[model samples]
Target: MNVILITACPSGMATTFLGARRLEQAAKRLGWQVSVEMHGELEAVTPVSAEAIAAAELVVVAAERVPEPQRFDGKRLFRAPIHQALPDPDAFLERAAREAATFDAASANAGAPATATPAPQAAGGNGQRRIVAVTACPTGVAHTFMAAEALAQAGKAMGHAIHVETQGSVGAQNALTADDIAAADVVVLACDIEVDDTRFAGKPIYRTSTGAALKQPKQTLETALVDAQVESSGAPQGGSAGAGGGARKSVKERGLYKHLLTGVSFMLPMVVAGGLCIALSFVFGIKAFEQEGTLAAALMQIGGGTAFKLMVPVLAGYIAYSIADRPGIAPGMIGGMLASTLGAGFIGGILAGFLAGYSASAVTRYVKLPASVESLKPILIIPLLASLFTGLVMIYVVGTPVAAILAGLTQFLNNMGSTNAVLLGLLLGAMMCFDMGGPVNKAAYTFGVGLLSTETYMPMAAIMAAGMVPPIAMGIATLLARGKFSQPEREAGKASFVLGLCFITEGAIPFAAKDPLRVIPLAMIGGAVTGALSMWFGIKLMAPHGGLFVLLIPNAVNMALLYLVAIAAGSLVTGVGYALLKRGESELPAVADAGSGAVAREQRTG
Candidate 1:
């Protein structure tokens, strides 16, 4: 059979090429004529000609993401994930051959599209259940779509109605409607990144990692539906939910975490803009803003006067938005402003956000209005009532204590600066690398972000530096100890270098996930060194993020030269440590699939 095969991945990196190579070998062994086309991170390579497609009897698509499937409308088609195709290409090719032979080419050419593999359909059951789900991952790539596809197939097999919304690099696709959401018996959130789930309030939510969905999709869906049943009936069906489920409480806390992270994610851009601008102002001199009509003064005005001043309010408003959607924004902003005015700082902003959000939600839920004026509740009543309550509580109850707490925090930071810089740096740095972007890493990051408003920037500098260390160190280690890592890992290391410089500590997750014992300790050591040096040099960073780019601003860091030196020193330490500690490839596991499903290692090879 004449076949045209296409391989695509998020980064168009190693997976695409490896999948192509695997398929080619299989096709050759099977005595089939096949041409492969690669679609990758930046662009297409060795693209198949239109003539090739027209002449081919079959088309095979191997991708985590299928781009423009309709292009092969009339051809017999077979599809699988690009990663899985690498491990066993011969099986896919054999299946493709059988499918192509059975498919009707004449009917396909006449008008109807040829579908070799029928989609999964749910078996008839007691009752048809409708499900709505969202799948997301940190990199917005592979795992997002993989999980969605898995869940859809699982739902089909169980004979349930399912619609999956994919939030990926291409953005949200097949988005769920309000009516659809309302109708669903349960909402499945398969994600590693924090997703806004306020819309699913009053509906039972089931939380699972993207990996879980990929690995055990049917079980994941079954658990969700069963939990919903338990919640609705107030009794466990078959005792499964009763035995292993605190599902409701878990879901509730997951929703809360999502809200907070949403706020932090939204607040980051403002911090970057304001901090960078303020840093730029120092280029013309420390007090350049005092002198009018200069570029530096304008930058200072825009960055410090406007952006910085708005940061806390923006953070709080978004947090409330995550909780109560649009209705809570006004009260949240007002509360944040009050917190700033009262010198309660970022901690106050967080409290204001939660207060405003919960108050707005309560008002929306409890306040009854005439049907004729029900629309007015969102526009007029909720905002008015929530605002008043939040404002009064902030002024009367929360303002003074929070301000005093903030003052105490500031004093503690000052003390650390003089007496415990190294210890503080070591602790923060280790925390940053400990779980990558998990709770520990976030705690360190949040602490640093909070300190920005207080002008205690040394901690922020140390945190950023330490966070950058793991990925860069891993990249350097790969280079220094070539025999210690597999071919695929080395490819991933190249991508890690860029990610490290961008302050994405999650870049090291692949290496650490594969061999945490060897990788994590070395990473922590490197991170600690970077953090200690940053503290020792008294490096101050206005921005909570930006990595090396932040160093470009003259006044952003107190000691730019030393900061670079520290990063280099840390990277070297980690690289040498890995070289000394890790045995040759004979002792290490093969790195064929080292990364979590979400990370875009494909970008590295392509």
Candidate 2:
């Protein structure tokens, strides 16, 4: 088959040529006729002739930004990311040939040129500043999405483009893109689990804990693009705190986690892919409760079975890429398989692969072995160790506890209204208001997700509503009376309202942190009231995270009206009380914002 290929990475960078060169090399090995064109930055070599694109049996585009399929009009186009080809020429040709042959077979039949488009290229692309977040917690549910929601709100409020990639029990949602990284001015990582930031190389990035971002979003904003490399001047290799390691100071170099994180970033879909598919399988296919028909069977075949099967390999493959630089794929795949067998899904598989790679690395480092032993690293040493460790830990420790907790939660929820309904709501709601996005907030979230197993989502929904209102109401009040907050604080209010609507209670952190005395109680009062009310009126929510945005997704929120009311009432009270308590306009910032000063206290005379 005759084939013509064009390669172009996001930056229109060198990878474009590399991909083309790789494909050409592959075709050469197979003794097949092929032509390659290069775009982006080609130093001396020119692209393949346009005539080739016109005459070829198939057109292959290894482009980071896949041009709209419409561009290739009648050409048989097979497009993939430039990464697929570069540095591995032979494999590229083989894959290209396979795709071309498939297209040829199609053309032989009653086929048109070939259907071109793949899933969406980019929807919700143009956000402020293009921030990419990997939100997570060990539990993979409540705290994960809550923190994700908080960070997204924070990003939007800061007027920066943003894309939040959630890493939770429900799996990843809104995966980040290379374009997202390239276009971003800043990266705010509000997470406990590791988030890969290597893609943000050369871009300013603020790595902060979820709690910190939620509680001090404005301060977080300060650290975002402007402060990741905090000092404006030739900043010290490391910041004053020296929080990062030695390798970290060099913006040019990345460490173990950096590489691993790269793969984790890509592996996000596996978690989601597997989980959502399995959920659909159970929902539509299995009919665990009763007999299901073809619809359920079909859903499981597409959603559950295949996607679930692909989970670990994808996770491992990406992580290996992070490590050993290029050659980690084989080891990563083997390790990933091992991880899956241990019941360690996507996130766990990543960890297993990393361990496998490093251990194989150690064997290479210490052992005076021959070249033959080297290949064994991937097929033997790496996979064996990673799989064993992952399996043992998952089954005996990680998986057991998780299963027990989930089981307990499910059982409890099933029994919730059966015994202590009102009391539970009050407790959960109070927790929601307790510290906004702190550990207290997470506890409430976990309870709700846990109850999800029992087919109960009300406790979580109420808690979320209660936790969301106080900050927004306070923001409204402050906006209404600019006299009640400092200049900076007043500006922050703009962000707070947005965060509040999104159910990010931590948006009011500055106010609460600065004036725990008056602000916290008012916020708490509103939050508690909101939560209690929501619980009294049952509300169901589907998406694990996001404030109101989650409301937009299919079957996202049940009893939306009541949920809105609960949040509104709480916000209103909080706003009114906060506005009234604030003293002089000048005093507000000193009282409510951490970055601002204390109210100039009047000196008492002797």
Structural similarity to truth (TM-score) of each candidate: 0.64, 0.46
lDDT by residue (tens digit), candidate 1, 159-275: 889999998756789999999987887789887655656466566667776656754578778757644421232323222111112233243444566666666766767877888
RMSD of each: 15.5, 25.0
Off by over 4 Å in 1: 1-188, 191-206, 209-255, 415-417, 588-606
| Candidate 1: C-alpha RMSD after superposition | 15.5
C-alpha lDDT of all candidate models, in order: 0.73, 0.57
lDDT value for candidate 2? Answer: 0.57
- C-alpha positional error of residue 344 in candidate 1 after TM-score superposition, expressed in Å: 0.6
Q: Candidate 2 on 331-380: residue-level lDDT in tens?
A: 56665665556544544565656765555444434444356565564456
Deviation of model 2 at 529, angstroms: 3.3
